[model samples]
Target: MTTVQQSFPVPPQVLWNALPAGVTAIGGQGPFYDAQRGYVTCRTGMTFFSWGQVVTAMVSPAAQGSTITVQTALKFGVFDWGEGKRLGTRFATAVAYAAGTAALT
Candidate 1:
């Protein structure tokens, strides 16, 4: 149930290409892309506990910049805490980096 949200000004395609490879390698699930669906999917996993893990992401383009949001639900053992707890312990480990390949003019 943990959620992490971040927004920065970046060009659309530059952000898009960086997403798949960047997110997955951090211990998430996929570079799930569907042209028709028009989005990319990413997931995260738990170590010893199944329910403690989570997977969530969003991909969209806007006039100013592209937006990507990633979220995961974490369950610690038998305890089901909300997004805050899960995000603090589990989701924090996941790292994503974005760099602009070229300037947009």
Candidate 2:
């Protein structure tokens, strides 16, 4: 799995609410939020260079704001050739943009 973690100067709920939009911006599908689990999950579409990936964003409260940890893994392979990390970065950027914090990039 490829993981990307980021901290934002916003409430956990704010970041959590932006997860779906972030996923969609990355060309993900079926973004599902599990409030009880404190996470959002989505799947990437298949393309010529990839088989698809499962992306998960877990949000947690912080002292001042919030922190998000995003994990990306290939649906059917042991190696993703850095695609997972790329997708994770894009997801985080989109979430930051949606949350009105474009400085996260």
Candidate 3:
């Protein structure tokens, strides 16, 4: 599994609102958010991918704003050929774009 974690100044609710659009931008569907757990899950429509390329976005309180992590695993393979990293980058980019942030780390 590969994970992309980023910190932003937006609150969880704001991030939650941006999630669906962001996920859709990356060919993801059925985004589900758990407020209690601060988790958002979805399935990606990535090519060469079976076994449900799941993406999990986690949000937590941060000193400045909030920290969000989007994690994905490439099933049925030991190596993803950087696909996991690409997925993370895509998700982070969407979120950052929605949040109106200058950039993500």
- Highest lDDT against the true fold, candidate: 2
Cα lDDT tens digits, model 1, 1-105, are 555554445655555556555455455564566545444555456554454354555555765565555566553454444543444323222323434432223
Which prediction has the highest TM-score against the true structure? 2
Kindly report which residue stretches of model 1 are placed more than 4 angstroms away from their true locations once superposed. Answer: 49-52, 62-64, 74-96, 101-105
Residue-wise C-alpha lDDT for candidate 3, range 1-105, written one tens digit per residue: 899888888776777667775687678878887888978888876476455478888877787678878898865667777777788778877877887774434
Write down the worst ten-residue block by lDDT for model 3: 44-53
Model 1, residue 55: what's the lDDT?
Answer: 54
lDDT for every model? Answer: 0.49, 0.86, 0.76
For residue 70, model 3's alpha carbon misses the true position, in angstroms, by 0.8
Q: At residue 12, what lDDT does model 2 achieve?
A: 89
Kindly list the per-residue Cα lDDT of model 2 for residues 10-33, writing each as its tens digit: 998999888877888789888888
What's the CA RMSD of model 2 in angstroms? 1.7
After superposing candidate 2 on the true structure, give the runs of residues whose Cα lies further than 4 Å from its correct spot. Answer: 102-105
Candidate 3 residue pairs that clash? none
What is candidate 2's CA lDDT for residue 13?
A: 90
Better of 1 and 3 by TM-score: 3
TM-score of each: 0.54, 0.90, 0.84
Worst 10 residues of 2 by lDDT: 96-105
